[model samples]
Target chain A: MTIGIVGAGALGLYYGALLQRAGHEVRFLLRRDFDAITRNGLRVTSPNGDFHLARVLGFRETHHMGQVDLVLVGLKTFANHHLPELVAPLLGPETRILTLQNGLGNEELLAANFDAARVLGGIAFLCSNRGEPGVVHHLDQGRIRLGEFTGGLSAYADSLAATFRQAGIPCEAVADLPKARWEKLVWNIPFNGLCALTGLTTDRLLALPATRDQVRAIMEEVITAANAQELSAPITTEFAARMITLTTAMGAYRPSMMIDRAEGRPLELEAIYALPLARAAEHGVAMTRVAMLHALLEAGEA
Target chain B: MTIGIVGAGALGLYYGALLQRAGHEVRFLLRRDFDAITRNGLRVTSPNGDFHLARVLGFRETHHMGQVDLVLVGLKTFANHHLPELVAPLLGPETRILTLQNGLGNEELLAANFDAARVLGGIAFLCSNRGEPGVVHHLDQGRIRLGEFTGGLSAYADSLAATFRQAGIPCEAVADLPKARWEKLVWNIPFNGLCALTGLTTDRLLALPATRDQVRAIMEEVITAANAQELSAPITTEFAARMITLTTAMGAYRPSMMIDRAEGRPLELEAIYALPLARAAEHGVAMTRVAMLHALLEAGEA
Candidate 1:
C-alpha cells in the first residue's frame, strides 16, 4: 500500500521511514525541507542507527501531492487550523486519514475538513521531536492505538496495522479508542502541565514529596471530571507514578509544552490544560490545580 | 543611642546608614565584607544620590559586638536559623531585637532563641539588593512597622519608631505586629512564589490577565486561612489588585526567592509558603492555589 505522511515532523518522519522500510511506497509532505529532501533525501536518526532514503517523493507544494492509500496526520495541534490546506491535495477517493496527534478536538477538525468515513481516531505514544530540518530523532518508542469513532474496525486499518507491525513499530487496532485517548489526556494534563509551568523534569518533580502529592491531586481532579463525563478509567496514584517513571525512562526528554515554553513559542496551553479545565468546570468538578496551571502558563514568561 | 545591625544585607545597610547620618552611632556585623569596609568604606547608592560613610564600624568577630541599645535584625528568613549564635553577643539588660524580614515564623524562631522581652516583630517594605562588596543599592524606600509580638507597644518600640522617624526613615509603631506581618504575607506567598517558579518579573507577571486571577485566588485562599485563624483583616480581590498595582509600581524587580533559586541558595519556601499552608490545613480551610504554589516551587527547575 502507498502511504502519504503529512507535516514531516518527528512523528511523520518516523512513520514514513518505518513504513518505507517495510517495502511500502511512502511519500512525505513537508513545507520547509521539501527542496532539500527532494535533492538529498529524508534523514532519520534512530537508536538502531541513522537511516537515509535516497529516493523518496518529497512534496513541497500541496498541489504536487498525488493520490495515496493512507494519510497519517502528525502536525502539532496548533497546526490544526491549517489542516484543510494540508490535506486538500492528498485526500483521494479511498484514502483513510489517521490522526495521531496530542490533545483533543483534532479529530473534529479533521472530520470537518474531510469526510468522516476517512477519519480514524488514534493515540500515539512515542517520544519523538524534530532534531533538525529533514532529520528526526526517535527518543523512546511506544505503540500507536487506532480505532474508528463509529466503533468498527475497517479493513484499511488492519492493513495499516499489519504494515506497522512488519516495520517493527507497535500498532494496535482497538474497538474503543476514546478510553485510550482520555487516559492519555488524563496523564498529560497533570504531568506535562506541571512540568511546563515549573520547568522541572519528571524525576525531579516526583522526587519532591510536595510536587508528587500535587501531581496526584491534579490527576485526581482530572480523573474526577473524566468519571463525571462517563469516560472514566483507572487513573490512580500508581498510574501517575508509572508515568513519572516512564517519562524518566525517556532520558531527559522535555515535554513538548516545556520545549515550546523554553523556546518562547506559543504553547498548546489552552488545548491541553485549559480545555480539560473547562470540561471539568462544566461537570462541576473543582479543578483548582489544573486551573492554576492554565493561569500560570497563560502568564508565563515565554 | 548605639545600634547594632545583624545580617547586613541591603535593608540593614540602608537603615544603619540613615541612623548614622542622624548622629547615632551604628555598626554592622560583617563576615564576608569586613576587610573591604575596613580598607575602604561602606557605599550606599540611592535614587537621590550616592554617599560614602568612612567611620562605619565593621566587626567580623561576633565577640567584638558589645551590647547596644537596639539591634536591627535585617536578614533574610533563611539566615534566621543562626539567631541563637548571632544574638548571644549583642544581648544586654536593655537590648531589644527588631526583625525586618519577609515571611512568617521568623519571630517564632527569634523568640525561641532569645527572651520574649527582647524580640520585636517588624516588616520592611523596601526593595533593595546587594550591589557590590561594600555597596547596597536602595531600590525603593518605604516605612517599617514595628511592635511587640506578644501584644501592645512598649518603651523599646516607641523609642525604635522615634529613632527611625528622626533619621528621615518612616516608621509606625503598632500595638499588633502579627496582623501586619500576615497582611504582607498574603502578597508575598502568591507573587513571590509565582515569580520564583516562573522566573518572571513582578510587572510582567501582573500584566498577564490569567496570572492576575491566579494571584487573586491565592490571596483569597490566604485571607480565608487568615480569617480561620481569627485575624479580622481580609485580603480581598481589591487588595490583590492593589498589590498588583504596587508590584507593578516597583518596576521590573525580581523576587528574592527567584534569585535564591537561581543561585541554588536554600529557599525560604517553608517559612514563606509552607507555614501558612500548614496553618490553613490545621484550620480546615481549602488553600487550593497556595497548595499548588507550594507544589510548583518544590518542582522548580533550579
Candidate 2:
C-alpha cells in the first residue's frame, strides 16, 4: 500500500517510520526537515523500540508526490488552511485522507475541499516530540482511534486500522466521528490549554491540586458540552480521573500544543479550542471554563 | 490630622505626599523602601504637578508610627496577609483604615484583622507605578471612589473625601462599598487579567478585534458574577462600553496586575479572580469566561 505523510512533524515521522518499517511504501511530505531527512533519512527513538530509516522518499512539494492509496495529515491545525491545495495532488478517486491532527473541524475542512467520503478522522493517543530535524522521540501510547467523519464503520477504515495494527500500532475504528472528536476534547481542551498557558508539563499540572481541580472542571465542561451537542461517546466524568492517572504515568510529557507555544510556533487554536466552543455554543452548552481557556489562548496568540 | 500610611508602595507614597502637602502629618510604614524614602524623602512626579517632600516621616517598624486618626492601607491584595500585624500598632479607637487596593475581599480581609467600622474600601481610579525605591510616577486620573465597607455615610468617610479633595485629588464617597468593588471589577477583571496573561497593554488589547471581544466577554462575565452576588453598582452592559472608551483614551496603560506578573511578583489572584469566582459559583451564576481567566491567572502564578 502506498501512503503519503503530510507535515512530517513528530506525529507524521513516528507513524510514517512505523508503517515504512512494516514494509509499506511511505513518502514523507517535508518542510524544514526536508534536507535533513533526505540526507540522513528519518530516525525515531521510542520506548517501544528505536527504528531508523536509513533512506526514504521525501518531497518538499506535494505536486510531485502524486496520488496514493492513503494520505495521513499530520499538520498542525493552525496550518490546515493550506490543506485543500496541499492535499489536492495526493488524492485519487479512491484515496482516503486520514487526519490525526489535534482538535475539531479538520475533517470538515478536508471534506470541504476533497470528497467527504474520503476524509477520515483519527485521534492519536500518543506522547511524542521532534528531537531534531529528522528525529522523533515517541514517549508512550501509540494508539490511533479511527472513525469516519460522516459516521459508521467503513471497509477503508477497517483496512486502515488493519494496516496500523500490522505496523504494531493499536487502532480502534469508532462509529460516531463527532463523538470520538469530543471524547478526545474531553482530555485535549484542559491538558493542552493548561500546559500551554501555564508552561507546565503534564505531571507538574497533575501534581498541583489547584491546577488538577481546574483540569477536572474543564474536562467536565467539555463532557457537558459534548452531551449538549448530542455527540455521544464513551466519555464520562470518570474520564477526567482516568486522564489524570494515564498522564501521571506518562511522566513529564509536554503536549503538542504546549511544545508549539514554547517553540514560538502557531497553535492549533481553531481546531482545539474555537470549533469545539462554537459547537458547544450552538448547542447552548455552558462551557465557561473552556471559554476562558479559549480566550486566554487566543489572547496569547494575538 | 495624623495619618499613617501602610504598605508604602506607589499608591501609598502618592497619597501620603498629597496629604503631607495638605498640611497633615503623614507617616509612611516602610519595608524595602525604608532606606531610600528616609534618605531621599517621597518624590512624586504627577501629571497634576511635581512634588518633592524634602524630608518625611518613615517607619521601619509599625510600633514607631503610633496611633493615628487615619490609616491608609495601600498594600497589594496578595500582601494583605501581613495586614493584621502591619496595621496593628497604627490603629486608635477612632483610626479609620482605608484600603485603596484593587479587587474584592480586601475590605473583608481588613475587617477580619481590624474593626469593621474602621475599614473602608476605595477604588483608586488612577494610573501610577513605582519608578524607583522612593519615586512614584503618577500618570493620570488621581481620583478615588471612597466607600465605607459596611455601607452608608460616615463622618470619617466625609473627612477623608474632604481631605482628598483639598489635596487636589478628586474623591467621591460612595454609599455602597461592595457595589463599588464590583463596579471596579467590571473594569479590573478583564483588563488586569488579560493584560497579565497576554502581556498586552490596554491599547494593544483593544487594537485587535478578537482580543477586544474577549475583553468585552470577560467584562460581561464579571458583571454577571457581580450581580449574582447581589452587589450591584452602576455596572450595566454599557459599563463595558464605557470602560473601553475610557481605557482607549488613557492610551497605553500597563495595569497593576500586568506589571506585577511581568516583574515576577506574585499576582493578586485571590482578591481579583478567585473570590469573585467563588461568589459567582455560590450564587449559581455561570461565569465560565471569568472562571477560565481565574484558572489561567492562578495557574500562571503556580
What pairs collide in candidate 1? none
lDDT (tens digit, per residue) of candidate 2 on A1-302: 99999988889999999999999999889988888999999999988889899998999899999899999999988888788889999988889999999988899899888889888999999888888788899989988999898789988888789989999999989878888788889889998988898788888878877678788888888888888876554467887788778889998889888988999998888898888888988988867777767767776786
lDDT per residue (tens digit) for residues B164-277 in model 2: 999877998988888778888888988998888888898988987767888888888888877777654446899889889999999999999999999999998888888888
Q: Over the stretch B64-133, how does candidate 1's per-residue lDDT look in tens digits? A: 9898888888777777768678877888897888888787887788888778877888887887777768
Stretch of 10 with least lDDT, candidate 1 chain A = A228-237
Candidate 2's C-alpha lDDT? 0.86
**TM-score values for chain B across all models:** 0.94, 0.96
Instruction: List candidate 2 stretches off by more than 4 Å.
Output: A92-94, A228-235, B109-114, B228-235, B279-286
* TM-score for each model: 0.91, 0.92
TM-score of 1: 0.91
Candidate 2 chain A weakest lDDT stretch, 10 residues: A227-236
Q: Which stretch of 10 consecutive residues in model 2 chain B shows the poorest summed lDDT?
A: B226-235
lDDT of 2 at A39: 98
Q: Report fnat in order of the candidates.
A: 0.89, 0.49
